[model samples]
Target: MSQSAPYALPFHHHGKSKVRVGRVWREGNVHHMVEWNVNTMIDSDMEHAFIKGENTGMTATDTQKNTVYVVAQRMSQRCTVEQFAIALAQHFVRTYPLVSKAKIYVEQKPWARVQQGGLPHDHGYALQGTEVRTVYVTYDKAGKLDVTAGIKELSVLKTTQSGYEGFLRDQYTLLPEVNDRIMASTVTSTWKYTSQPPCYDAAFNAARGALLEGFLGPAKGGIYSPSVQFTLYDMAKILLDRVPQAESVFLNMPNLHFLPCAPVGSTFKNDVYVATSEPHGNIEAVVTRRTAAPHVSKL
Candidate 1:
């Protein structure tokens, strides 16, 4: 908002690192993640006058652009997406006193670096999916602050293990039992930490590890699941229980259907149907509370 004049356009430049991705798979499942980085630049006078229209000393859009690039350059190598978010939030607010508010958002993309032998290549990588981590920050002149971060496009599955029972059945049911079959889903999982972690690597690693293990491992053979919904609850619990910094986990899973296939006469067989990834089941929960962890930061 520009305050110099009712029509004053206090200049601010914005840029975001869009559509970045990374992926790694362990034991037959593919894992992917994404992120987007953003920045904004506004000169002091322009900032001070956005609401007051006092654009006497506004920074030019060209300068703002240059500044964004400069900030990006300064931030690219050393900052985590969260730090970059914090920097972006702090930068414009301090730069412009007129700026009553500022916001920064980072969205992550899923991808995998091609492995040479058994490990990821030194520098080469590839995008996997549209899912991502989302981070948002906002600051107000009143000293109010907000920050949120989470993951995306977390797909998972296991063969002949998970189940979906206790739903209504109809007369069009020519379908067979689903007791032991492949359960597949392309999931979007997000968990927002209440605060920035002192150790970003540790928090990220723990979340990633728990997600992988939970998706791949069925906790108990028979006692673990009453249904898919229940299983999702368990998954959220595991994530909350295992990941320290996160205060909550949100999961969006698209049930990807595969042909119910079986072997016959020593050959592969297909149930013969097209698989789909839409009209997904949505699950959300608070996995942790800020009171539980001293290291957890406030939003």
Candidate 2:
């Protein structure tokens, strides 16, 4: 009888991560800039590297990091984060015959042009808080492609017009129901495209606008949010409606609690709150069109 292998190499993938790059393009006196943190991973048949320490088929993580900068340099001035991710994914799979599949993840820092008097400055920029635009793309040698775009650290809050009630009570329950309360969350959302959009920047903007509109309702009178779950569903639904190319939307909105506090020898009138980040509620869901096929996200 032939000797059998001691261990099975069931699955393996390797790449570089957190490769930060900043690219600037100049048009006369104006300049445009983008900063991205990128990560790359590739799936290939490299069992020998694990079993026998053969390194011929392995792609170095440093090489993967260089590839990100090289691809970014080749991109056009108008390139979006989604486009860069797709290009990087395609490059790995096409360049290396052993690479069967490649996945690229990118996060863009929000930087807006600063205003000089009342007009936008030509070359001055300011970081826009903590929010970021994110993109994930995967490509295979067989021409399979998947793309997802999203927003991260999108914080929103409303003082009133939100409440939580009618929860399942147990013997250990100590919370009380209220008709008015502060609602806040740091939203992290992702939406998978059915196909590549013509303009990724436009598609992202539209989806973000829909999410904000759905959450706040209108400028005059905001909509009442009965629960975080209800608001999450509505946000996803609105995004799908606004962007036809998006097949599905996934939202992760944690309830950042603002507990009401009363002053010394004073009655509580919902006037004060003790904001807390930890021990908060987590609410998330996926919304899709009725006819759209189900999507299995790798995020």
Candidate with top TM-score is 2
The residue-by-residue lDDT of candidate 2 on 1-299, one tens digit each, is 12484767689999998999998888889889999999999998887787778889788899999999999999867689998898899999999989999989899999999998899888899999888999989999999999989998999988988988999999999989988999999999999999888999999999999989878889887999999999999999899988999998988899999999998999789899999999999988788888776565444
lDDT of 2 at 47: 75
lDDT of 1 by residue, 1-299 (tens): 52454574536543333323222223335433323444443223344454555657554445544544455555634456666666666766777655556666666454456788998765556777554655666766676666566566666666556666556779986555555556666655666666567866567667766766666674555233344566666666777777665767666555566655345554434343445666544544444554543222121
Cα RMSD for predicted model 1: 8.2
Cα lDDT of candidate 2 equals 0.90
Q: Which residue segments of model 1 deviate by more than 4 Å?
A: 1-67, 109-131, 142-145, 170-177, 218-226, 261-274, 278-299
lDDT of each: 0.56, 0.90
lDDT (Cα, 0-100) at 152 in candidate 1:
64
